[model samples]
Structure formats: structure tokens, C-alpha cells
Target chain A: MKSLIVVMALSIATLVGLVCMRVQATQSGKNQESAVSQSTISSDSNSELAQGAPANPQTSSDSGRSLVLVASLTVFVLSVFVGFEIIAKVPPTLHTPLMSGSNAISGITVVGAIIAAGYKETGIGSFFGMVAIVLAMINVVGGFLVTHRMLLMFKKR
Target chain B: MNALVPLLYLVASVLFIVGLKVMSLPRTAVRGNLLGALGMLLAILTTIFDRGVTGYLFIAIGLIAGTVIGTLMAKNVAMTAMPQMVGMLNGLGGGASVLVAFSDLLNTSDHHVDTLIAVGLSGLIGAVTFWGSLVAYAKLEEWPQFKKPHSLPSQQLINAGLVGLNCLFIAILAFSHNSAIQIACYLGIAISGSFLGVFLVNPIGGADMPVVISLMNSYSGIAGAATGFVIDNNALIIAGALVGASGIILTQIMCKAMNRSLSNVLFGVMAGGGSAGNVDEIYANVRSTSPDDIAMILDGAQRVVFVPGYGMAVAQAQHAVRELSKVLEARGAVVEYAIHPVAGRMPGHMNVLLAEADVSYDKLKEMDEINPTLDSVDVAIVIGANDVVNPSARTDPKSPIAGMPIIDVDKCRTVIVIKRSLSPGFAGIPNPLFAMPNTLMYYADGQQAVLDIVKAVKAL
Candidate 1:
């Protein structure tokens, strides 16, 4: 178990490092693709700060776990409303691409699948976790790639 | 490290909402997709680093295999096959949730009632979404066995029974503490739910597919949320809830467009036993016209509206349509594209196809915007569309598409329909618009017909 944990930790760290490098590469590549678009991306990300509430630190207290669970439920409820509100006024023409895009976002279950695969002790749990991870990754990767490919065609003018 | 985990998830959640918000406009949609992808990456990395996870080999293998398979499929899939692809991927998403939620339940030595309930619900919803999505894919791709609506005798009763059995199994598992019994209950819930999924989606006719697909998308999201509760992951919960709500809204929009309720869509078994023999009678009235003669009609027309449907996608005719529109515009004819809300297999399907052909966004007009002034338009050119423009939608109360809103092409001075045959749409009902006095059927492949028209118009 200890060996597995060490190997897992090392691999995760390495993967994270690789991901960061790839992100940097993409950012540079994006800049070269279009300076105007690059400016818009940076400006859009900054606006995220205007939304209220960073993570509530109280979730980490000795209630052991349910506190975090409760906090999660709260976030879940709020996000449903936000999701509806954000997309309410979308024109009919964008309904297809937008739905496909959001379907990709729901593949966020990859995070849970990864955690399940990595955190379990028994072989059965690990096997199911691996399957889950693969499926979720497929959703995430396929959903995003297809969406991006589709979006590339939606040029103005 | 602890503070960082929640903070990262929060950031991820914010990014997802922002991404979806900005995606409404074509200009920022690509960036929105990128932001969402980045958010997913952050959330996954944070979860891996949090604690207790140790199966690096499995994670690595899954990630690599998934990335390769997903990338290949996404890059290779043609735009015309996109609906089936989306349906297939949605099934994968649901399948993942089912496995994750089931495994988590299996690993649980100490049982909480709430956890059991969550697991059961997730398993039920996930299985339904998974199998339902598969059926949707088959239907869309026209798999022989699934091509027609497959319904049991008294389908509503059977579906109700399946639903009841699923709830009963969940209740038994939630109350039972015995491990063996609980496992059996879980299996029961999954099997019953899978059967329910097949039954629920099988009854829906092809015309109602957009709604079914949208609803299945919602089911997957709801299932993911239930799984999040089982695992207590904030990112999964938030993201799943967002998709769940958004999908339901999209489904409602489709239903409204079709003038049907959710129940009518799911349980109505709409296709029934309509005779196929009448198709011959219907087509006897179709009058075929050459592209040159139609071009002559367009030579003097002041306004022209192009209505495109699934046939446009099949024939890959958007570019031809765009070119033809440009020619018409240059000839001092006002040209615009009228889009029915449920025009194609998926929402905004026509827009995506047109956008790909570099059709100016403003030239595409929604149904309501164009319907009011359709009578003033000199020519309405329908490319491979059927039900969405059928006059039966407004005139015949007994028609399957009765009360559904459609592009008012019939009211236009001259209606030109470009289609291969006088075939019915998904509804298996004849379109009266094809035989109307002003309507001219240009029987040809959508692409060939449009290209020929473009050439003919150029010659004129």
C-alpha cells in the first residue's frame, strides 16, 4: 500500500508538472494564433474575481467530513440556479453548440473517478475506479475536442 | 494544502459557469470551451493531490487510453454524424457515474442510509442515461432494429412498473444493513433501471428525438450529481447540477417548439399505426421543376428566404446555399435564412452547418422573426426540410405535428422545396406544403440542386 501510494504520488506530481508545461505551451501558441483573441481570453478570466465568495475555510474543521459535504450541497444548489440564469437568454442558433459544450463540462466526474481509482485499497474498487476514470476521461476529452472543433467553424463575418 | 483544495474547486466551479455563459455568443465560444477544459484540468489535479489516492498505474493507463480514443473519435467524426456522437459520449458519461457510484457503494463497509439512497439513485439514473443514450445513438444513426420506434404493448404500463420496481429496490437497499442483500438490491436496481431506460426512449418517434436526446443529457447530469453526493465531491456536484438544470431547460425549449409536453413526448407513443400506403398518394401531387425555371422566378423576386433542415446536413449543402444566397444578394434580391427552433436533429443544428459555410450570422433569422413577414417574401426556398414547414402543423388539429410552430413558408408568394422525394419526415406524415399550388418540388440531392441553382442563377 505504501509503495503504491508513493508511486501514485510521484506519478501524479509528474503528470501535474507535464500539464502545467502544456498549459504554458498552449498559452504561447494561443498568443501567436491571434493577439486580439489572446487579449480577450486574459480579460475574461480576470472578470471571474467579481463573483463573490472564495472557498469557505470552515469546511476543514473537525466535523470530519459532513461539513465539507454540506458545503458541497450548498454549492451544488447555487450552481444549478447560476447555470440556468447564465444560459437563459441564449439565442436559438447557439442552443446546439452550447448544449454540447455544457455536456462536456458535466464530464467533470473525471475528478471523482481519478480520486476513486487512486484512493481505494481493494482490487475490485480499483478496477471499477479505472473503468470510471476511462469513461469520464473519454467524456471530458471527446466532449471538449468535439465542441472546440465545432466552435472553430462559428466565425463571425 | 487543505485550504487549497476547496479554493481550487471553487475556482473550477466559477470557471465552468463563466465558460457556459460566454459560449452563447459565437465570438467567445472557443475561448469559453478552452476555459472549461482548463477548469476541468485544475479540478482533476487538485483531487489527485488531496489525499489517500494511490493507483497511479490505473490512472495513467485510463487517462492515456481515454485521451487517445477520445481524440481520434472527435477529430474523425464528421459534422453530419455529430448528433450520434454526442449521444454516444453522453452514454459514456453516464456509464462512468454508474460505475463510480456502484464501486463506492461496494467499498462502503459502514453504511449510512443517506449514502445508500444516493448510490441507488445514482445507479438508477446512470443506468437509464447510459442505455437510453445508446438507444438514442442507434435511432439517430438509423440502426435497423432501432430505426423505427420500438414499443411494447401497453408501453406506459410496463414503464410504470419498471419505475416502481426501481424505487422499491432502492428502498430495500436503503433500509437493509446485510451486505449480501444490499448487493443484490443494487443489482436489481441497475437491471430494472436499464430496462426502464430502453423502454422510456424506445417509444419516442424520430420526430421527438431532439427532446429525448436533451432529456437523456439531463438524466446523465442528474445521475452525475447523485454520484457526487455518494462521493461528496464538490466539483462533481456543482458541475453535474449545472448540466442537469441546463439540460432540462433545453429539453423544455424543444418541447415548446414542437408544441408538446414532456409527458406527451415520453409516454405518448406518437407514431402508432399510420399507413405507409398513403405516401404514394401524397407524392402523386408533387410537381418537379428545373433549376433554370426556378432561377427565372428568383430573377424578379424582391425577397427570398432559405429554410434548411437535416437534408441540408446529409447533402452537405450549406456552402452551396451560402453561395446561392450571395448571388441572390448581388442581384438586388433580399436574401435571408429562416431557422426553425427544432430545425435539425439537434438544436441550432442548421446554424452550425450554415456557420461552417461562412454564412453571415445576421443573415440567419429565427422562425418567429421571419414567420410574421413570410407573406411579403417573394420566394421561400426549402432545402430538404419537411415537418418544420408543413402547413398541417397549423391547419390540421389531428396531425401529429398539430399545434407545433413552423416556418411560415407556405404563406410566401412562391414556395420551392428541394428534396429527393415526397417522403414524410420523422412524423411519418405527409407535408401538405409540397402539393400546395405555389409550392414547387425540386427533386434532387440538396447539394446538387443548390449548386445547380447557383449555376443557373449565375447564367441568368
Candidate 2:
């Protein structure tokens, strides 16, 4: 229990740190708008040909990449905390539906699969991406529908 | 329109969280599921409209095919087969993550060290989750080859070796600048991770499937999160982390319910270690009865508690059990179900089966909730359940299931166990509860026995 408290406190600290970092990044990004306009222009010019380029540049500097990583990690850790708190309140009776519902949520990978499949280059990459999209769509559709079916059964007398 | 993408994603994320929060209660759970589906729909639509997604042919085909298949599966699956259904879905989710990571790796020409590491981790964990979930599905479906636990020589050593190989590949993939070397290392990591998954889950017995499935669910989530990192998507990371956390909590709950450590369950060493020599001694006073006799006892009972297990699921006796409970309740006998945490092939298995039979969720009492009131129960009908009701859990320290929490049905005035034979349960140990002076065993299929008792009770 003490350890749980410590972990909670640590996570809260991390959350604060992440929020501060995001604020700083946004402020800095606004200040550097003119300075980075050249790089932005170059990326926009490449975007037409590159087709499936990521939001950030592939050759992002070390600090830029690390910032993205840190932001992503922050979201991951905080979301986990939210998951634990909400899911722990679920009774044993709803365990199955909770599992199937959350299983459906993991199908969020479909978003990534979509980008991969719909990328302009239609070749081996698109082929595998299409397959991934199909698989993820199945997970999303089947998982949600099945969970709904099961939940519909937990009725009153 | 470009600014709306992140805003819409944020909405979807909030919807997902609200959906899960509202699902804590049965009355609101159905709506909660629908809300979650809405979030998924929103996220999918937003992604489709996002910049760089210029091609739509493959997306259209994939979505149509997936919807058709998914609808059929959701509509046609039997309640008894839910464990395998969930297992299959986990495997597919993991499989999708692996392909997403692969496609991301191929599409990007330049790679940052962090993105490369994330890609490697996603491939490894996703491949492991996919194969491990398939093995779990096969085991749960009771495939002939997987009916019994199988272990290779020095299984742990082999698993460790596979982990080492995967780590080495991930390191090389992260450091390597050559596209060919990176791709090769990625494939190598996936292959080794697949083997590690199979080997890790293969030796676990059927009784530990709940833990295995939950852990796999967690792995699938972590894999998705890794893919999120690879692609730099906040929605994917948040959703995946939520699932990862949910699975971990469920796995911990299951392990605690069985009074076994996670490592003990994973090692698959819990079986065949019971005190078999005392079986005859324990069964010396075992008493047998008929359905009519059980009905006679039930006729005078004021309160009854029904304990259902995996055997109830095996016989598909939930409806019959519900019928019996209705008959008992009509006669002024208070009827309630006592559900153990790890009752069936998965967590909440019995509740789902019973709920399908029109049994109200409110009537279902958890083990900790019902155990104290069991002594007041005039009749405890343990249908197709064994280890959960075994008194040895409380009495015998040397027993494999000792220290595990049980239903304490033995404390009731009369205990009626409906089973086919004097056979032991998954634990493979004789239950002294069957031999207690107040206990009576009725031999028949769970559904048949319940039907017979219902008929006899109606006649009485």
C-alpha cells in the first residue's frame, strides 16, 4: 500500500513535468515560427512526393525526436494510471465485458494501419499495410460487437 | 480541417475513458459498450480523413471484409466459446500491431534511434502476443494436442535463449543504419519472439488459462503502445496504455484469487502435486444420492446457493441451472449464485453464461460476499463445480489448492454436488467436502441432473 502511494506520487510528478514540457514546447514553437519556416517549407514541398511521410521529419534533430518521445511516454504513463483507477472499480461480474471492451480499444492500432495502407506508394508497403488494416478492423469490429452482445445479456430480472 | 484532427482524436479518447468508467455497473454497461464503439468509429473516420492518407481502395476493401467477418463472428459465437473468442481477438490485435510496425519501418527512409527502438519492441512484443494468444485459444478450445501441458527439455533455458536473441536483434536494428540490416534484424526479432511466446504459454495447464489470457491481453496492449511510439500518435498510445493497465489489473486479480504467484502460474508446476495417497481415506465416508433425494432435501430449504464452475460450462447447464433456481425461488427458497473469481475458463465466465440464461446480475454474489452468508443457506447446490467448493482448501495445508480461497459451501446445512463421477477436478485431488457427513453427491450430467431435480421439486 505504501509502495502504491509512492508510485502514485511519482506518476503525478511525471504528469506535471509532461504538462510543463508541453507548455514550453508550444511557446518555443510559436517563438521559432519564422526561424523554422524554411524547414517547414522544405517539408511541405517534399510532402507532395513523399506521400506517406510522418508528421515530423524523418531526419528530426536529437532534441526534437526526444521531445516527441517524452511527450508520447507521458501520455502512455498517465493513461495507464487512468486505466487502473477506472478498471479497478469494475466488479468481478463485469470482468469479461471489461476485457472484451478494452480489447476493442487496443484495436486503436487501426489508425496507424490506415495511414500505412493509404500511403500514396502502392506496393509491398501498401500490401502489408492493407493486411494490417484488415486484421485491425476485424479486431475493432468483432471486439466491440461481441462486447456489446455480452453486455446486453447482463439484464435485470 | 487540419486543426480538427487532433481535436477529434481528443474527443474520441475522452469518449473511450467515459465508456469504460460507465461500464462499472450492469445497468449502464450496454450503453457504455456502444459509447466505446462510437469512439472507435470516430477515431477511424478521423484517421481516414487525415493528411497523407491519399489512397482509399485498400482501406475500403479491408473495412468491408473486416466488417462482414467480424459481424458473423459476433453474432454466431456460443456463450460457452467466449474464452476462445476473446483469445482469437487478442491474437488478431497483436497480429495487426506487428504489420503496422513493419509497414511503418518500410515507409520511413530515415530513422531516429527512439523510433527504431520502438519499432523493434513493437515487432517483438506484437509477435509474441499473436502466437501466445493463438496457443491460448487452442488450449481453451481443447484441441487434442493441447489437451495436456507439454514442456520441452529445459523449457525455461530455451525461453531465456529466445529472449536473448530477440534483445540482440532489437539492439542491432536500433544501431544499424543500413536498411537491409534493419529489416533483417526486425524479422529476426519477430521470429525469436514468436518462439518465446509459444514456449512460455505451452506448458501452462488449462486451470491457469485465465491468467495466461489476461497477460496476453496486456502484452497486446503494450505492443500497440510501442507501435504508437513508433508512429508518434497520442490516441494510439493512450488507448493502448489503458488496455495494458486493465489487463494487468485483471491478471493480478486472477492470480490473487487462486492464491498463487504470477511466476508459479507461468511455470506450470502446480499440477500433479496434490496428496493423492489420501484419496481412499478421504472418500471412505462419501455418500451418493439421486435427483429425487436432492429435491426432497430442497423442498424444506428456505435459502439455496448455487455454485457453478467450468463443468457447468462444459455441459452447457446454465439455462437448466437457472430453471432450477426459478423453481426453488417459486417455492419461497431464496436463490442466489455464488461465483468464484476463477470459476470457469476465464474471469466472469459463469456470470456471462448465467446472464445469458436470464439470470439477473444482481442475484450473482461474489465469493467474498456470499461466503459469510453461506452458513445460513439451508441447501448449497454445487453444480458441476469442484475445487472452488473443496473444504481441503481450508483444512489441508499440504494440498496443492491449500490457502486458496473457496466458496465455503461446506458450512451450509446441506451440500449437494451434481457431478458425473467421483473424478477429481482440474487440481486432480479428492475433495473431502464430498465425504462430509452433510454432503451428498448426485451422479449425472450437470444439465440432466438439474432438469431431473427441477421435475422432482415441481412434483413435490
Candidate 3:
């Protein structure tokens, strides 16, 4: 538990450093729009986000467990609908880029990958986790950039 | 902070939806891309804060290395090679899910039935998607000599058997308590699933590559969704579902363009159909025209349409074609480009090619829009397109491409087909449109032919 706290502290420090760099970059008029958005979102949720700490399952009741599962299922079903509706209207001319673009979005698994890799110190587990992180990051970065490059070529009248 | 995490995730999901919505149009696509990227950033930050994740050293390394490599690859890939790049990215997504599920199973002290089921699915789908996408990349790049369709005897039976074996292994892994036994079962499931993926994609002909790639992409999304269930991550689940749904819709669109069902694409090779008969017999009555003659025809024509295909992409003729169109327009001809949905190797491939050549998006008409008035078109210039414009889809129900939606370029007053030879198209089927009296085949490479036509038109 102590090691876990130390790890978290280190990560917090790193995140702070990144935020500072982002602020500097933005001041210099670099393309740091994402930094601005990130700061805005973080500031809005700064207090409550820390309150939503991980709850140990040992103390949670069975009803709580079931409720979590139910909530997740609801989210899943609703997301499926949201996905179908949004993509249904995509023009045939944009299908390939869209596929690749959303492909990058699915790389959200990198979030899972980071937890898997860093949550434990076991050799085998960490190794697999690191591999996952790398692969998912590649998908995330490459897919979006490629989609952006392709979409930029298209011109309107 | 905890309450804020879900709210942030919800915001991120909405951004993704908006991004996709805006991406449907050419005008807002770049902004849409930015929105999606912003969503990703927000989601990643939320995960970090909510989970209170540690071990920054490795995370920093992986993130930096991946960003650098992925960015370089995205920047360097030529437009023609975009499909393979997409294939690689899809495979990586699947591979990541597989690893995540494997790690989750390893770390969990108590495996609930639901979690086990989710992990099992993650492993199975991820394995298939990974291997299948690799084969797709190989086929697209023609990296290995084994590009030809290779099917085992009783292929469907074998595929079904592999699937059954994989399911049984998953069941054993989930139910068994012995760590040793569970590990063995896990390995078994992965191996069988990987082989199944290879078998599934190996026999699919190159003509169906677009559908196969899209299907694999969907599998990767399903795998990610399964991983989300295992880890109980709302953002992952939402993102995965979005990709999966969109990919399925795209795959369906590809199948419809080719007049093929998904099942037909997966197992069509079992029939072992031969390539459409000899080109010699089909091209015997075809008349050949020179650039000068085509130029002469175009000089007097008022309504002209240019139909481009994969051949134009291969010869890099889009710019030349654009120039030829400009010259025709200068000669008082109302020139337009007709794009078949499945004209190029990938979906919207031809559009990207034409757009790169500075062709105005407004002047490019879809098959449905252009086909209706084809009869009124004075000159239809077909550059390296065959099957999509083939009249076989209309006249011969027995043809392989019959029922497929093709541009009705054959109905024009004069159809000028610019190709290197009388060779068949990617489908390996001879186009009977070449034999029509109104059609004149200009035997030349696509880029060279268009340039020649431009020169000849200038002289006229």
C-alpha cells in the first residue's frame, strides 16, 4: 500500500510537470488547444474527481455489485445505439477514413493497458501490460493522424 | 473526483459522437478529428486520475515511443498505402485487448463468472482479429508469395471445428481453479483462435479485401468491448461499441457495393469457381481507338464524364485526368467525374485520390446520381475501370459481378476505355462492355493515355 501511494505521488508529479509545460507551450502560441481543454475539464472536476476514489469490494454489499453491473450494461446498450445512429449518416466517400478514425477511438483500451501494466509489479504481468500499452498507443496515435491526413485532402466547392 | 470521472467520460463520449457526425462531411472533417482527439485526451486523463494509477516510468516510455513511431508511420505512408496502414493499426488495437485481458486474468485473485466470460471472449476475439488483420496487411502489401487463395479441404468443417475447440478451451479456463490448468487452457484458446483467424482470411480472394479488412476491424472493437467488461471501464466499453458498430455498417456498405453478402465473402471460395473465361474470346470483337480519335470525339462532345478505377490509382493518373478534364471544360464540354462506391481498393479510395488531384468535390457524382443520365452523356471516358462499368451486371445474371451496382457508362453515346491491355479487372472477370460497338478501347497505361489525350486535344 505504501509503494502504491509513492507510485501515485510520482505520477501526480509527472502530470503536474506536463501541465506546466502545456501552459508554457500555449503562452508561446504553439498548437496547445488540447492543453486548454484538458485544463478546463480538470479544473471543473478537480475536487469531486478525487472523491470518487476506488472502493474496496470487500466492504461493498451485493446490491452495490449488482448495481454497478447494471449501470455498465445500461451504458453499453446506450453506447451501441449512439454509435449506430452517428455512423449511419456518414457518406460513402468518408467510410474508409471514418473506419480508421473510429479505430483510433477504440484504442481507448490503452487506458486499460496502462492500469494493467502499472497496477502490479509482477514480472510477467507487467511485461504483458507494457506490451498492451505500446500496441494500444500505436493504434491511438497512428489511426487518428492518418485519418486527419486523409480528410484534409478533401476540398469543398 | 470520483463523481467527476464518470461525468468526464460522458462528455468524452459525446465528443466522439459529435466528431463522427462532423466527419461525415468534407467541410468539417478536420475539426471533427480535433474533437475526437480531445475526447481521447480527456478520457486518458480521467482514467489516470480515477484509478490513481502508478508506475509512471514505464507508462512514459511506452507512450512516448508509441507516439513517435505512430506519428512517423502516419506521416510517411503514401496515400496509396493507406489501407495497409489502417490494417496495421487495427491489428495493434486487437493485440492490445488480448494483452489487457491476459493481464487482468493473471492479476485477479478471485475470478467471477462474468469476469471470466468477458476475459475469455476478449482473448478469443482479440486473437482472431490480430492474426486476421496481419494476413490482411500481408495480402494488401503482397509481402509474401502466398497471396493466392489457399483453402483446406472441407474448409467450413475445419473452421467450425476450430471454433468449437476454442469455445471448449475457454469454458475449461473459466471453470477450472487450478492455476496450472487455467494457464494451459488459456494458451490453447489463443492458439486455436489464432489459427482460425488465419484460416478465415487466407481463402478470401483479393477482390474482397475491403470487406475482410473492415470485418477484422469490427472484431478488434468487439475484443476491446469484452476487455472493458472484464475491467469494468465505462469509457472503454463505449469507445469499443462505437467502433464495432461503425465497422459493421461500413462492412455492410462494402458488401452492398459488390452485391455480395457477408457470408458470401467469408465462405465463397468453397465453391471453387473458375475465373471468367479467356480474355481473348471476349476481346475479339472489341475495337481499339487511339488518343487522337478520343480527343477528336471529346472535341465535339458537350456532356462528358470521366470514370476512374483502381487502375487510375495504380498508374497515378489522377492529376493527368484532372488536367484532361480541365482541357475538356475549356473546350466548352461540361466535364464531371463519376465515382463507383467500390471503385478503388478501399472504400472512398478513389475519392481520396481524386481529391488529392484537386478535383472539385461538387463535380464528382456518385454512381446513383450519374447513372440516371448516362444516356445523355456524349462521351464517357473510362480510365482503368472495368467491372464497375461492365454491362454484365445488367445483361448477364450468371456473371460473377452480376447484380453488383455498376456505373451505366455503357449507355453513353461513346464509351472510351483507357487501359493497358484487354486484361481482366481485379475480379479476374472479362468485361463484355469492351465488346460493345459504341465502346472504343484505347490500349495504353492510364497515366500515359490521359496525358496523350490531353496533348491530342490541345492540337485539336
Candidate 4:
């Protein structure tokens, strides 16, 4: 019941935001400002949509959502434990290259988002979902690509 | 399509875990990152239709607007302020999450006590992180100086007082679930976060932007994760966790890069300001070398390691550097790029730069991995980078960066500096590395100098 309310509220904001975005274009002259505005809209759109109707039963509860959470949590715990085991001795020797590589991972999200967002699907929700996916894609892909080039320094000897 | 959400969630989570794990290893890190990113994309798409939509108007507008702005940011923002830009994005991310939490609060009417309470908590934490990041962004770009009151009667007390009142309002949220209370909390936290943000970052010097960026990034992730709990989103939960874990790791890396503990940096607790002797005057006749002189040196070298810094980034000379590397490689001289932990304006700043020029991922080397090779690397090309390559960390006790690890570039057969001026780097300390016996200064813009060197090598 509460989840539905949250989704409904989000949908209203997204609707309002979409309308207000027309104003944003006219009001803000800067492109980044509009980009910020775009993020503003999508941030609301999904939550609103998620709460509005019967979301995939899987994402609606912790018990059902346990798979991904379990995977991430277990890894997080292991990383913490392992990281501590090697604490202060890791020497950060691999930090620069690793950062570059992870940043590249952040870049790869762009491809997925592009695929989803650029196309039109039967459901309007899916269509907008695709768009949001595209935006997310840009963030991930761009971030990772940059990272790869940075870490290239550590390749071999 | 409905089942797609869970499928993608599982996939994204696995990728995130694998990507993060693989990123821990240098050789497969890039590929791991790419896979994780693909997972995130899948999660994002799943979440999009998680909310049912009636029209495509908003979607279309968002795509167009975000694309245009992101493009401009990519094209226009100078490389020197990339950290600030990255911080700005974090602020935006946290800010949106906070606002979404607030909107959820506004929508509550029939009084689902649990939901209202969750949203309130999410809002408070998210607000702090979002607004806090905004202040960090401003400091990195507009004000690169540290600021703090030498003696404040009760700085901590005042902030605590405001936050206490904010918590009082949160109690009301449990009973009433009112938007008005939500408004008050938002205002309270906004003011408090602004103060906390200034207090946190203002005392930090410009040299620590990477840490500041990572810390802020951590805050952003926490905010998003908190919001996930409020919304009960499987995708949000997973995405937020990935971001949070990665952010925490980034902070750790950033802290290590500066050779300081995160706790020490955060509490205004520092070991030393810097090595004073590093700045002590030394008499040496400084002479500038032209592109031809550098070319001759490069041509004769058996191996070369090009160390790109913010100067190289400002020069936008990645292509020339790549071409020069190819030239050296053709002549049977091994070429590699040396990346310092904190070499550029932001974390991974140098990597992004070189990739923009299409340099392959196979030729870069980490500081630790390459430092041992300086003894054999015939020439160490020092571009616009400063502090990371500075030699004082090893010898000076009074210096701020004393005891911090730095590249052993001075150990190389010869060092060539490509810069436009003698101005000090972020640390405001003159590099003795520039005046070492085998070091030669090439006073020119990085791109022009590298291009010139490429031409000179051709002539040779």
C-alpha cells in the first residue's frame, strides 16, 4: 500500500517535472543546467512509475530482492574482511591503475542505457525506462573508458 | 518484460560484484569495469518501467536535455577542473535522490507510519550528503585555499544544536507523517549541511581534492542507498550498494594517494604542513631546452616512460604523446606511460585524458609498478604534474608532503620537464626534481613541445 503511494507521488512529480522541464529549457541558458534538469526529471520518473502500479514482485520486497542484495552484501563483506587482512600493507601500489580500470567500468553503463533509451517500446513506462537506461549508460561507460586508459600504465612491465 | 527486472537486477548485481572484484586486479580491471557498467545499464532500464508511464514526452525531454548538457560538459569544461565537475555530478545525484525522498513524503496522506518514517530518515541523510557535496564542488573549483577559524567558541556545538532540532522534527514524522514537518527537516538539514560542508572542506588544502572528491562521492552513495530503503526498490538497493562500496573504495584509494589517513584528513588533523626545506632557495642556472634538444635525447634513449600530469592534460597533447611513443617504439625503444596516484586534477585524470587521444590500454604503467624501472627508463617525461613527482617527500622532514610516497623519476637516466612557467603546483612547493643533475627543463606548452619533439625525432 505504501509502495503504491510512493510510486503515485513520484508519477505526479515526474508529470509535473516534465511540464516544468519545458520551462527549464526556456529559463536556463546553460546546457549543463539542462543536463542537471534532465537528471532531475528521470530521478523522479522511475520512482513514480515503480510506486504507481504493481512493480515486478521481485523488487518490491527484501525477501524477493535477496539475490542481488546477497551477492553484493557477501562481496562487500569479503572485500572488507580481505581488505582489512591486508590493511596498511596494501601500499596502494595498484591504486592508480585500478582507479583507471574502475572508472572505465563506470563508462560501460552508457552502452546499455543507449540501447534501452533510444528505442520505443509498447508500454510507455518501458519507453521512458529505456530513456533512463540510456542516461545511466552514458554515466557508466564514460566513467570506465577513462579508467581503462589511466590504468594502461600498469600493463606488464 | 516484467520478469526482466529481476533478471537484470541479478545480472547487474553479479556484474557489479565481479567488476569491483576484477577492478581489484590491475590486468583485468578495465574489462571488469565494463561488465559492471553493463549491469548498471540493465538495472536502470528495469527501474525505468518499474514505474508505469502513460506518455513519452518526459522521457524524450530528459534524453535531449541530459545529452546536450553532458556533451557540453565533456567538450567545454577544462581538464584542470575535472574533479570539480565530477563533484558537481555527485551533488546532482545525491540531490535528486534527496528530492525524490521528499516528494515521497509529500505524497503520504493516509498515514502509513512506517513509510513516512523511512522517507524522513532518507531525506535527512540525503540532504546532508547532497548539499555537502555542493560546497565541496565550489571549494575545488572556485576556492582552492583552506579556510577555518583559528578559535571558534563552539562551532561543533552550534551545528549539533541545529541537527538536534532537526531530529526532534523527525520524531514528529513518526506520528503525523506531515509534509510540513518534512519541509522543516529539509530546511534544517540544508542549513546544517551547508555549515558542515564548509567546515569539512574549507580547512583542506587544494592538494587534497582527490580525497575530497572521493569522500563526497561516498556521501552521494550513502544518500542513494538510504533512499533505496525508503522506496523499497530492488534496483535502487543494488545500484546504491554498488555505488556505496565503490565510493568507499575510492575514498580509501584517494586517502592513500595523498599519504594520509582519511580520519586524519577529515578532522583537520595533519602530521606536518609540508617540507619547508623543499622551498628553501637553491642556486642553479636554469636553462630551457627546445623540442630538438628533447628529441635528440629521446632518439638516443633505450627506453622512455612518459609521465603525464595536469600540465600534459592542459596541453591536450595526448595524441602527440601517443605518436611520439609510436615513433620511439618504431625505433626499437620501449615506451611506457607512468601514472602517479594523484598525478592530475582528479582521480584517473590522466587516464581519461590519454584515452581521449585514443591511447591503447596496454601501454600505461602504475607508479609502484614503474618506479622500480626508473633506474632503467632512459628518460622520464615530466609534464604538467608537480607534487606527486616532487622529490622532497623522501628527504624533507618539515615539508607538508614529507613521508608521502612519490615517483622515483629522479632515478631515471634523464628527466625532462615540459611546462610553461615556474609556478608551483597545488602544494605551492618548488620541485627540486626540476634542478637535479640529469634533469632538463623544456619551457613550452606540453602539446606544442611534444609535437615539436616528434618532429625533431623525425629529423634525427
lDDT of 1 by residue, B1-460 (tens): 3235655876787778778877878788889888899999998887776654666888888888888888998899887787788888888889888888777655544445666788899899999999999999989988889887878898888888998998899999888756667778998988998998898888777777889888888888888888877775556777898899888998999999999899988887665323677656666677879999999999999999999988888888888998999999999999999998788887777787888788877888999898899999999999978889988889888787889999989899999999998777877788878888899999999999999999999998
Q: List the residue pairs that clash in candidate 2.
A: none
Q: Model 4 reaches what TM-score against the true structure?
A: 0.69
**Model 1 chain B poorest ten-residue lDDT run:** B105-114
Worst 10 residues of 4 chain A by lDDT: A53-62
lDDT of 1 by residue, A78-138 (tens): 6676667767767877777777778888788787677667744546766788898888888
Best lDDT goes to which candidate? 2
Q: In candidate 4, what are the lDDT values of residues B147-265, reduced to their tens digit?
A: 32122456557657756765766666656433455456655655565555555565566567678777766565555555554544433444454555555676777778778888667
lDDT of 3 by residue, B254-293 (tens): 8999998999999985232235455666777999989889
lDDT of 4 by residue, A1-157 (tens): 4423433443343233334434434444333332232222233333444354312221223332243234333433333333223222223434443433333233322322232233233344334334433343333443444444444544433
| Chain A vs. native, model 2, TM-score | 0.64
Deviating ranges (above 4 Å) for candidate 2: A1-60, B274-277
Any runs in candidate 1 off by more than 4 Å, and if so which?
Answer: A1-73, B271-287
Candidate order by lDDT, decreasing, is: 2, 3, 1, 4
Question: Candidate 3: which stretches are off by over 4 Å?
Answer: A1-63, B270-282
For model 2, residues B333-372, the per-residue Cα lDDT tens digits are 8999999999977778888988999999989999999998
Q: Which stretches of candidate 4 lie over 4 Å from their true place?
A: A1-157, B1-12, B15-85, B109-117, B139-172, B175-179, B267-280, B285-293
TM-score of 2: 0.92
| Per-prediction TM-score | 0.86, 0.92, 0.88, 0.69
Q: Best candidate per TM-score, number? A: 2
- Model 1 quality (TM-score): 0.86
